[model samples]
Every structure is written in C-alpha cells, then in structure tokens.
Target chain A: MKLRKSEDSENEVELNMTPMIDVVFLLIIFFMVVSELSTLNLEEIELPLADESEVLKSEKLDARHIICNVREDGTIRIQGNSYKKEQLADYLKVEADAEEREPANPSNPAVPPSKLYLTIRAHKDTKFENVQNVFDACSQNGIYKTRVMATKDE
Target chain B: MIARLLRRRPRSRSSRPKAVEEAKLELTPMIDCVFLLLIFFMCNLEFVKQDGLIKAFLPKDRGQSTGPSVTDLGEVRVKLLWCAPGTTIETEDRDVGEVVLKIEKNVYPRSGATPDWEMLYLDLVKMRDIRDRSGNPDALPVIIDARPLVPHAAVVGALNACVKARIKDVTFAAPERPF
Candidate 1:
C-alpha cells in the first residue's frame, strides 16, 4: 500500500491578524489623546448667532484663556464651580495675577506679561446683566481681552 | 558499505529536541476593546468647533455718567421693546412674548403694535448701506437700548441684525427704568 502525504492532505489557508491588530491599537491611542485634550468642562447652552462673528484660530496657542459660563437663570460658573459676582471678581483677580507671573515660554524668559483672554459662554436667554457682571469683573482685574461666544450664522 | 556507514554514525551529545512552536497572540479581545474606544471617540469628536466669538469692550468706569448734551454725536439709535403676553399670571420661566424694534420715527412690525425682526433687519441694512454710500465711515456706532424686561435673546436678535449690516461698533444703553 502507498503511504499518504500528510502535508498535502492539510493544505489550509490562514489569515495573519497581527498587522490588523497593530493598526487598530494605533487608532485607539490617537482618539484617546484627542478626546482628552478637547474636552470642555463647561455646560452646553444655546448660544446666540452672529453674522460677523470671527472664528478663534489662536485658541491652541494661548493656554491662559479664562472660560466662564452663564446659565439661563443668570448664574455664573467658572471651572465647574459656582460663584457670586463678588466672589467671581476675587477669583478673576487671583487668576490675573497668576497669569501675569507665569512666563510666556521656559526657553524665552524675557517676554512681557501676556494679556489674559476671558471667554464668556452665555445662554441665548441669559440676562445681559449676567454677562455685564463678568465684564465688570474682568475690567476690575485689568484683564481686557474679552470675547463673547456666539454661534456662526450659516 | 555506504548504508552500513550511515547506520554506524553516532548521535552527538549536544543534539536535543527543538523547543515547541511559539504561542499565538489572542487578538479577539484586543480588537473588541479597540473598536469600542473608536466608537466612543467618534461620537464625542467636534470637528468644526462651531462656536465663534465677538470681541466686546466693557465700560471701564462701570457705566458712570461722564456728562450730558453730546447731541452732535451722529450715532444711530435702535430701541428694542419687550412686551409680556396678555395673561393674568406670569411665571418665572414665561416665554418671551413679543419684541418690537424701533429706529427713530419708524416702528417695526407695526407702529407700537407688533414684533417683526425680519423687517427690522431689512431696514437696518438699508440705513447702513445708505450711510456707507454717503462716504460716512463704515464703522458707524449703533446704540441698542433694550428694556429691563426684555429677554436677552431679543437683544441678541437686534444685535444680529446690526452685525449683518456690517456695523461693528455697538453699545448697549443702560436699562435704568424699572419694568
């Protein structure tokens, strides 16, 4: 009797999953880093639409921009913490001082104190006085770069 | 003689059985976790960052009066009047009833009657364009006087109209009178 060849009897194709898994893992890491960096702590609210509103392209360059939110009920929140107008002013003063003392760059230590930008995100129905109060706080602390957040009109 | 020589060759002392084949990596669980993370991030990603910004200059003096009788100032004034719904009871979260936009002698929607923001926008664009053609500075200041009872949305709508006309210098009048 003739001996049957074992290798010829079991000629099956197999897929190599190593490269696919490596690509999937790379994509996962990329998304994780982007989501963490872009997350905003403020609550989402209905912002007013503006025809002439300009896009903020320099947000990534500046790390000292202050973000404040005003709810529909006229309450102000900063970094997820509620604050009365008086307390908010005090808080802004401390932030302004801290920003003034921080160096623009570690390598270039001779730069002047960079101006702090205050970004106010208020609901469409939020009282104007609520925004004005935050404005008052910024002026009192000598922080003049103020921006009101609005939706771009399509 | 050759067959006898091959059979007589002794096995070397260092010769040993080869090690078993390396274990295969489990990819099923790892691929599942990766797909889950990919979905989570895709849902949360905000591509356009739809929020825009309007730069504002707050009064440094806390809106204190400087003086009176500056009538020579040729700034255009736009007034926004808020009207409550014709109901006996008013709730804390009552919807903003109606808004009337007024510019000089002409009243929008109707003369002290109805609220129509579309008409107000058209009129504002017309006035702004006429001034621009008359060699006036493009950045003419507009004063938006809103009532104390006016909802902020109403004021923003008026502001949107002014901005649509390419008029950037906007200042809000102090809401002094009690509603």
Candidate 2:
C-alpha cells in the first residue's frame, strides 16, 4: 500500500504562551484577593432565616466590629474565644471603651451610644435569653447598634 | 507572483519545509501542568459566604439605671411572649418563652395558647399604610419587646415584619420583669 503524504507533518507550530501565562497569573491574583477578604474572624453558627433581612454590604463591614457567637449553653464566643455570661459583660465594656464613642444622643445628651459595631451570631435554637444577655452587656457598655446575623430566605 | 501569494515554495524541491528548522515544543506537558495548578487552586478556593442581618438599635434604657428614666416606648410595641400550646399568658412557662407573639394583649385565639406572628406582621403593615397616608411613613419607630426567654426566631419574625412594613427604626427593649 502507498503511504499518504501529509502537508502539516512538516510544519512546526509554536503556541505563544505569554497570553496564557498572563491569564493564569490574573486568575491567581483574583483568587488570592477573594480569599483574603473571606478570612474574617468569625465563628460558624446556624442563623435564623428572614425574608426582609438586610444583606451584609462592604460598607457595613468595619474593621473593628465584634462578633458574638452565642451557643445553647449560654456562653458567648468571640473569634474562637469563649466568655461566660458574667464575663461577657466585662469583656464587652472593655471592647466598647476601646472604640470611639458615638456622638451624644440628641434626646439624651448624657448617654452617648458606643461606636462599637456588635454582630450577634447565635444558633437559631438557642434561647433568646442568651442573646438578650449579650444585648444587656452591650447596653451596659453603651453599645446600641447591633445586627443579628441570619440566613437569607429564598 | 500569483503562485508565491497562493502557496509558499520550498527553498529546495527535495528538502523539508522551512518551518521544520525550529525545535519542536512538547506542549502537552506544559498544558497538563498548567491545568493541574489551576485545578489545585480552584479546589482550594473557598466561596464567599452570603448572610443577612436583622438590624436593631437597642433603646437607651436597656442595661443601665443611670440613663434618663424617661421611658420612650414605641408607638407600635410588638411584644413576643413564651407560652405553651393551649395555655393562657398567665399559664406560660417563664423558664423558656418559645416565641408566642400573642399573650394577654394580643389575644386573637381567645384561648391565648398559640402565638400569632402573622397578626403582628399584618398589624405593622396596617400601621405603615396609615402613616403613609398621613405622609409620615418613617415616623413610627417599632419596639420589639420580647420576653427574656422567648426563642430568637420569634423576635426575628417580629423584626422581619417591621422591616417589611418599611419601618424607619426598629429597637429592642429590656423592660423590667413584670411578674
């Protein structure tokens, strides 16, 4: 049998890898940035679902905000450190004092709210008392602004 | 000139094409390695989590007695109490108020056992519409005064209702225990 002649067999094709490498490097950078933003000091807990809950935005995410993870056992967890009910109050006062104090209330000039942004992340099944204690602690420390984290309802 | 444009001629008729002069590159290995790295990073990457929050600013009177004793109760106060099934507000187990919206004040069922979250939502919506007609939609600030032991879900439900009603401000109350 006679062999068939192939024209492409003699030509050497070189793919330019510059663009591919550039694209790859760009993808790597994108992932790195996203991972850095996701590395927040937060504890994982089951949050309740709410249809009208406000979605977390970049503006709402401040660098100095504290997250309190309350469990069914009534212990508050902050960045993996657990604080008892009694201890939470003291810890919160210290944290509140560290942040800038809010401007004095227009109605009540004597008691200014704390500038501390407190986010309460509690298990859905956890009793409200535990969360209330956190609020009470916040109130004692003059922190009035709070947001309870929840899952967005479909 | 036409032949040169249509087809490039070999320098020598008996020799190989001019392109064969450069060394051949083994692209398969490089492509495979690149894909492997991409897969590794893709597998390792974590997706950003999406969460919602129920916004609240506690009343100035919550934890301290030193604040002004003037109690600024909400015009529309939604109280969530903890009660058992088929039990009246008086008979509710105080240890854990499992999120019943109606007790004695919001007595819808008359039996007073079941909490009415929907009623709370409807009432707040009605309040919003009335305020809107009066041209002060944002004038009403709602206070969700949930008992200490009520389930957190119940409070969220109440807050969600107020938010849906487009209430301007929603606050929680730390009322003195009224046993």
Tens digits of per-residue lDDT for model 2 on A1-154? 1233345544537455656766876777776665554443455566777888777676545647887888766668886678887789889878877888867666656557787788888887677788888888888778887888888864
Poorly placed runs, candidate 1 (over 4 Å): A1-37, A58-63, A97-114, A142-144, B1-27, B59-72, B86-97, B104-106, B110-115, B129-138, B175-179
The candidates' interface RMSDs, in order, read: 11.5, 8.0
For the predicted complex of model 2, DockQ is 0.35
TM-score of each: 0.65, 0.67
Runs in model 2 deviating more than 4 A are A1-40, A58-63, A106-111, B1-45, B60-63, B66-74, B90-98, B109-116, B131-138, B175-179
**Comparing to the true complex, what docking class would candidate 2 get?**
acceptable
* lDDT (tens digit, per residue) of candidate 1 on A2-66: 23465554453656555666676677788877666554444677887766677867676756887
Mind listing the fnat for each candidate?
0.50, 0.60
**In angstroms, how far off is A87's CA in candidate 1?**
2.0
Report the C-alpha lDDT of model 2 over B1-179, residue by residue, as the tens digit: 22223234345544666666644445557657767777666765644466788777776544465465343533667777666555434324655334456522555453243355566677778877776788753567677777766667777777877887777767776645545
Against the correct fold, how does model 2 do in TM-score?
0.67
| Residue range B48-116, candidate 1, lDDT tens digits | 366777776443333233345232266778876655554312223335545556786554445332445
